[model samples]
Structure formats: structure tokens, C-alpha cells
Target: MSQNLGLRLCLVVLLCLSGCNAFNGGSTETASITPAGVPTDDPNATRGLAPGLTNHGVVDSIALGDAHEAVLSNTSFTIHGKTTVKYSNGTLRRQGERTARVVNPRDRRYINVSIYTQNKIRSDQKSTNNSFWSNGERVLVALSSSQTNSTTYQHFESRDPQYPILKYHPQKERYYTLFQAVDTKVINHTTNNGTTLYRLTSTEIADSAQLIEYSMNVKIAQNPRNLTFHAVIDSRGVVHEYRLAYTATLTETNPSTSVRVVSTTRYTKMGSTTVDRPSWYAKANNTTPEPPTTYS
Candidate 1:
């Protein structure tokens, strides 16, 4: 009788473990658009922004409360854009374009992003067709299950850390914290195709300690140079474009060289984009799942 009871207990524990796996496992549903305007394949579809909401309304809501959290939680959209980074001498160092979908406005972890390089490459060589997605716990590459560091994931997930790829999703806390040591202002405004654009600018003087906190690879002298920012927002309160210009003295090598770097990004295709789940996700549902550490 004791042996039979022990067997029953083991079976019960196995059943509970199976249930937990089913709950935490990544989904494998086919991507489908519903009549209700929700994308069925999106894990966060049930938590998406209200249907037919306008950019203007989103902006007003953000301004009325916690700007970053409110905008991130209440806005959902698709955006595609290009980013160019140049050296102080105006030489282009890198340029790339990315397309992304945010099915759930409140949580950036539910986003899907695809990226490509602008420079032409040989067909035989693998092109930069990088893709990323988040499965609730953390971000993962579309075809792989390996975990990615937050900073690296944030780089491709949002592209520009200073100005997240989400048009209205500002990094308010980071901005405010940095601004305490800098000067910022609304430099100007312009109108185009019924949309008004406001330009905001900021400048900061920093030392090695401040630069280190930002995770920069290079070292700089005390009171190095200046770091400047310029962002343009549309009438509906969406960021149309942003640029960051930084100058500092390098401390990594001899002679302590001064360097300047500039990065610029532009956003487009805001409200009408959708991303399909990867094919592997569907396959995983029918078969035994590989360990989470597995990579494609």
C-alpha cells in the first residue's frame, strides 16, 4: 500500500510540472488578423491599445501622467526607419534600416523587430537579416532561444536608446536624470502636410565618471567636451526624428585624442503594421520543445 501511494504522489508531481511547462512555453499559433482588429498570433494582442485610437489622443494621455510609462503602455503601432551614425569628421561609419511592430503599447517586451544593413553585400555571404522578439520573460532572437543582454536587446529593440523607436515612447527618466547635468530647450517648430513639428535640443558637459555610467567604451578627461541632442516631434506628439552629437577626449590610449560622434534616426509607417510569428514557433508547438539554451 505504501509503494502504491508513493507512485501516485510521483504521478501527481509530474502532472503539475507538465502544467507549468504548458503555461510558460512559448506560443505556436499561426498569425491571423481578427475581425476585431486584433492579431491572434500576438501573445499580447488581448492587451493592445484601443482600436482606432489616434496619435493625438495618445500624446495627451502621456502628458497628463507618467510620460514614459503612460506612452509605452497606451500606444501600439508599427514603425520602420533608418539610422545613420557618423564620425566627428562627417564620415559615415554605419547605417541600417529596421521594421518593427508593437502589438501591446504598455509593454515593450511584446515587440517584434527585423533589421538590415544599407550597404550592399555578396549574395553568398549572409546578409544582416537579424530579427528579435520577446516571449514575456525576456527578449529572444526569432529563430533561437538564447537569452540576450538588456543593453544589446534594447539597442535593436528600440535602435536609439535616447529616443526609443516607439514614436511617443520617450525615455523620460533617463532624459530627466541626464538633463539635471545639462541644458535643454525647445529650439523651434515647423509644419508639413498638416502636421506640426517641434524641435527639442539639449547640451551637456561631462567628465570621465559621468561618461562611464553611460556605458561608453572610451575614457575621457575631466570636463571633456559637450554632448548635444536634437529631437523633432509631430503635432500629434509622435517623434518624427532625433539626433545626438557627442564630443569627448579618449582616455584609452596615448596622446588622448578628441572624438566626436553623431547618430540620427527617422521614423515612418506608424499605425498600419503587423508581424507574423516565426515558423519555428509553430513547429515547436507540435514537437517536444528544445531546451531554452538552444540557438537556431
Candidate 2:
């Protein structure tokens, strides 16, 4: 696993553990939308909402491990955006951020993304990076797989933003997925670009099944517990952003260990984003397109 416990601890736990803690001021109240709407570079944009979001008409509802996906299917969703994660375990800590750009919101291929991670242990920070992008027509992967120690990158015909990358085998947080942990205190706020957005926040509770989806097909991690979360979702059901914070029990260590994690995902620069070829892509794409790899 990578030195940073955020990706390592959360993903390493896999099917092992769950939960986190945060401020719990969520109410089912619906906040009125302020008319800060002006079209951006994203053609699908309308304030914080995308196209195709439907209302369930259920307010003040806290659906823990229930009906969260009902909101996802109807969402036009953000295929181009950024995601960030942070983790800590006593003296050990980690922080990382990911930027992604998918060519089509309807397709998972021909994407551009980069992940930068750092670990803080023993008063020192060590960093590593991973990426998936195109050179010409073929795609290249700079992932350090769990089953291999090879230093060279892998080449693919196409890229999946969710495909596991980096040594810790962490997947890119897809815009289509949402954790059911948020209870939500609804409100509307404007972005720096003058785009109005909706927000919902609350403390998190352990849900191992949800955490498992975060882990890749690598070594098992600890069970997450007492997690806290918040999300930016509009009345139309578009999810603009979310943050998850929690700790999990690590049994691999003698005295069961607890690792703290904070994961934040948001959508920005939607339709305007593009995936440009990285300097290393040409070198990594030297061979024929290999079979596509399975993701978490």
C-alpha cells in the first residue's frame, strides 16, 4: 500500500471495516435556490444542476444505506471534475488529490486524469504520482499494480477513470456514485465562478459495504467506523460535491490500529475540461494496446 493512509488505509480495508465522525447538523429542510444561473462552458449546466435530474419530493429524509442510488440514475452527472482524499493513523498520515476529464459523460473511455499522493510519517513526507491519459490514439497507464513490482507503465486501448492506479490500487472517484452516509442540512451557495450550488451535510455512520466499493481488488484494509459526510446536491438531484471523513480498525497490526480518513469529491470545469497527452504517455504507449484492466 502507498505510504498515505487515506488511500492505503481506506482501500486496504476493502471488505474489512467501516464508519467515521463529523458535525451532525443535517435537517431534511429544503433551501430556496438563489437565481445565480448563467451558462458556463458546460453545455449541460444550470446552476449546480446538470441535465436529467428528477425530484423524489421527499424532504427531511435521511436515507442511510437506502435509496441513495435512486438519485444517481436520474442525474446527468459530472464526468469532468476533481476529487481529493486525506487519511491519518496516529503519527502516520496521507493526503492526495485527483483531477479528471472524461471525453463523454456517457462513456468511460478516452479520459485524462492525474493523482498526486504524499505520506507523512516520522516527520517526513514522501510523494508518488500516477496517471491515465492518451498519447495519440492509444491510452497509457502509469499504475503500480498490487500484483506486480515492475516499474514500467501499462498501455491500454482506452481508459476508465474508475480503474485502479498507483501502488495502493485506488480508483478514481466516479461522479455517478454517492455514499448514503449523508443526512444533510440543505442550503444554497454560489461558486467562485458565480454558479449557484446546493449543499447537504451531516455526520457519517459505519457502512462496510459502501467502503468496500472504495477498495480495489488488492489486500484487505480495516473496517471504517463512525464516518461523517456532507454533499452538494441540488433539488433536481444533481450531486455537485461531497466529503467523507472517518476511521477504520486495522487488525494487521498487533494492538488493533485505527486510521483516520477524509475523502472529498466535487465537480468542477465540467464540459470545458479536456484530457491532454502527458509527457510520459508516448513512452508508456510504446506497445500494442493490451487488454483493458478491471477496476475496483
Candidate 3:
């Protein structure tokens, strides 16, 4: 394949894998869960639990830890990361930091982050939603605006203009909507060493309820396949804790060989929590109980 075509194909695959919808904004919302063989809640009790843990029948909250660890063939990549999540007051606060090393590509590395609150930005920008800068250079700008007469939040941004903008709609289940995209199909699914494997693909964007949404292409051919099931958690219903099993796939183009590559990233018990923040404004105020670390 020509270098240009190869680049296009690589971009498409990346889009499908990550669901990179840069233009759409999103907010944390509640999701219902029904795991089988679990005990139903007892209405008489003031508290409840998710069946596997403690006997606190009047349970008001629960917590859990999750990790994504994987190994892959056909590519050389190493991912190291951890995430912390707390749920309460009908909201979820998640913070995480990840760093990856590419042995092939260009011998370069970058840090990726996702913090639940707007605390990641400046105070002024926090309210209206603003850009994230490094050393006075605006690397990313996020706008938190709403669609007319709708409960949904629309986030549109050029986090890195060199890459396309992203849009995320939490209310719609359209995890990511990528515009002007491209694709490459390599391994169906495979793992190496002790890591777990997960793969994702994207179909053309579909219009749902008059809103545009993209369907995610996901594959799990490893021991912890359950870990990759795009879980939407509603802690209020489950009782004491919220548990997450997340598995993500990443592919990088070999600048020299231009080979399309993949990896199986892995981990266990990456995050858990017993606290929650009501709103971004409240979190900003620092009125809530002190989390081990204060971002804003």
C-alpha cells in the first residue's frame, strides 16, 4: 500500500478502536445494572448490597477496584496506568493517569488523562468549560454547551487540531462519533504473556432518535472478556459499591515499516470509592469531604 493510503487506513482503525468523538461533550449519568443469580433488594431494609459482599442489608454505599491488563502480538507496546472512581449523590467522580511507550513507531511517549471534574482546567474556564494548555500553548479547548431544549450536553472541541474534533453524548449511548474517518483490519483477537486482549471497531455513524451516534466494534477473546463489556453503572441501585472491568485496545503505525499494530493492555482493581460529589460546582467549592487528593 502507498504511504498515504497506509496512513489513512491507520487513522480509520484508530478511530474505530478508541471511538474518538472529539466534538461531542458528555456528563456522568446513572445507568441500571441487572447481574444474574444475584439476590434482589429487600424493600423493608433501609440499605442494600450487590449480593457478593458484606451483610449490611441497610447498605447505603459500595466500592470496587478494576484494572485492564493485556498483551498483544504483531506490535510492541507497554501501557502502565491506574484510575480512581467514587460514586454518590447521583454522580460519579473518576480520575486517572496513563503513560504508554511505543518501542517501534518513533520511540516517543505521551501522558493521557481523564478527570471527572472540570478542575483539570483554569478557574475561569472551569465554569464555562475551557481549554487545557501546557506551557502557555493551547493544546485542547472543550466547550460544554447543550442542544436546544434538551437534557443532553454537547461537547465539541479541538483538543489537538492536528487530530479531528470529538463529540460525546452520554444520554445517547453513542460513546463516540468520529467525523471524516478511515480503517485497517488485522487480527480478529489474540493475546500474549499474562495480558488480556480487547479489540474495538466502528461502523458508519447512525442517526438515532434524530441524533447522530456511532456503534462501537468490540471484541474480547481472553480470560477477562467480561472486563471489556462497556459497563454503565448506577451505584444508587446496587447498594454500597461500584465495580468496573475496563479493557481498551490501542494501535500505532510503524513510521518505518508502516505496519498497522495492536496491543492487549491489562490490570486488576484499578479504582474504587465510597464518596461522591453532587455537581461540578460543588466539587469546585471544595465543600465536600477531602478526597485523598484535591484536584481543584
Candidate 4:
């Protein structure tokens, strides 16, 4: 039970984009708009907002746990563009392309798009299995479960003779460790429907940074205390780029929670990046083909 609770907590934290702390400043003030005039990018645009907020180069700070209380320290990555990697042979590689589906609740219309990538290698090696949906169902499955050279690269790293990958026992549920306890902060800003969203600003505080467990099935760390998420969402609440961070402690049971999951969950992205409906969403489905359902 404790393990389950811890896992759930970690899942929630990992799903938090712009940090859970920055979701402060809330008012139940609801606004309505005609379906014909609703902005395609902003799902909540009618809540009294304009357009042109998501122009290029917007910066937002996010906070979690304490609702923007104190400033965080020792931030590591000054996230600029996508993380780049170069092979030993000098061949540069990057993550796959990004795409989005614009949801217009008022008009009952949606637009599916694949934001093209600049790198030929990156684009060529990208996964085309996209799954766009109106709700949680699989609207479009464009890519197959094919592995690439990069995928094989990580697999080789795990099993390499020099740095043998951690072993995992299926029946017993065991595996080797992949990461140590670490801490870092992420900063991003984007405009949606003409609203300037400020994340982890000066007022927000970084409560605590601790190590937790990681998972592959859920692609999230099992940190009940602190989990980090970075989401580049479209106007209609569709995520374009989603990044997560957390720590993994090396212990039998967390002294704080006394739960066990073999090895700790680290700060790494799990699961395959296919085009499917938003994985972390329920009601706000982006499934293709059928129109998405929502509570008006």
C-alpha cells in the first residue's frame, strides 16, 4: 500500500508540467465563447483572454508542492533548445519531431499537424507512429514499434561488457541501477491564446529536492514528494514537448515512507515516443477520427 501511494505520488509529480508549484493564482472565473470563434490553440481562451500569446521565445517559471513560495537553488540545465548528442563518429543526433492537434471545443473542430524538424538525420530517424485523438482513445496510430540505432545504442550501453546494463528479473521484479541521486531545475515559457503564463518565478520557492524511484511502464519516477515536468503545450491543451526530472535513492525502503520498489526511479524518460493521444490526460482527449468529448 505504501509503495502504491508512493508510486501514485510520483506519477502525479512527473505529470506536472511547468512544475506543480506554478499552478497557483487560481480563480473559478469561467468564461464562454462561441464555437465558431473559439481559438484553436487555447482550450481555456474564452475564460477572458486574447490571442498571440504563444509567440516564439517566451519564458515561464514553474513551481510545485508549495505553490510558488521560495526560490529554488542549484538549477543545472539552462534549457535552450532540444538536447543534442554526437556519436563517436561525429554523427549528430537529436530527438524525434514534434506535432500537435488543435482542439476547438466551441466549433467541434480539430487540426492535426506535425511540426517539421530541421535536422535531416533527426527527421529521418524520427518515429512516425503518431496517435491523435479527441479523447483518450487511439485516433491515429501512424508509427510502428520499430527500434532505431539510437534505441540500440542505449540497449548496448546497458549490456556493454565495460558497463554492463543492470539486470532485471521478471518473476522476481528486479533490475540494475541506471542513475544516482541528482537535482536540477528547468525553465520554459510559451504563449497560448494570448495569456502570459509565468512559471517558477522569483516568488515561487523550491521546497525540497530528494531522490525517488523510477519506472518504465509509466515512464515516471516513483517520487511521492517532488517530481518535475516540462510541457510545451499547444493552444488546445495538447502537449508538444514534455520533459520530466527527478531523483532515485539507493535504499531498501525510503526512510521517509518505508516503501520498496527494488531500485529507485531516476530522472529519465521511459516508454516509446509514438503519436498517440496525450498519455497523461483523461477527459481532454486528443484522439483522431472521432471528435473528442468534453464537459461543457
> For every model in order, what is the number of clashing pairs?
2, 21, 36, 41
For model 4, the local distance difference test gives 0.23
CA lDDT, candidate 3, residue 84: 32
| Cα TM-score of candidate 2 | 0.52
Cα lDDT tens digits for candidate 1, 12-115: 32221111011101222211212222233556533313211122112132342233334434555544333333345665433334445665642343233222
TM-score of each: 0.46, 0.52, 0.22, 0.23
Choose 3 or 4, whichever is better by lDDT.
4
Write down the TM-score for model 3: 0.22
Q: Give me the candidate number with maximum lDDT.
A: 2
Candidate that would win on TM-score: 2
lDDT of 3 at 67: 10
lDDT by residue for model 3 (220-253), tens:
1111111211221122221111112322221221
Cα lDDT, all candidates: 0.37, 0.41, 0.23, 0.23
Q: Write the per-residue lDDT of candidate 4 for residues 1-296, one digit (tens) a residue.
A: 35324323432332221111111112211122222322335665324111212222112212121111111111111111121222224343322221222221211111121211224544554332222233222222221223332211101111111110111101011111111122322133345367333221121213322223222222332433334443332232212223333332323223422121211111111122122334423432232222232223
**1 or 4, which is superior by TM-score?**
1
> Between the candidate structures 1 and 2, which one is better when assessed by lDDT?
2
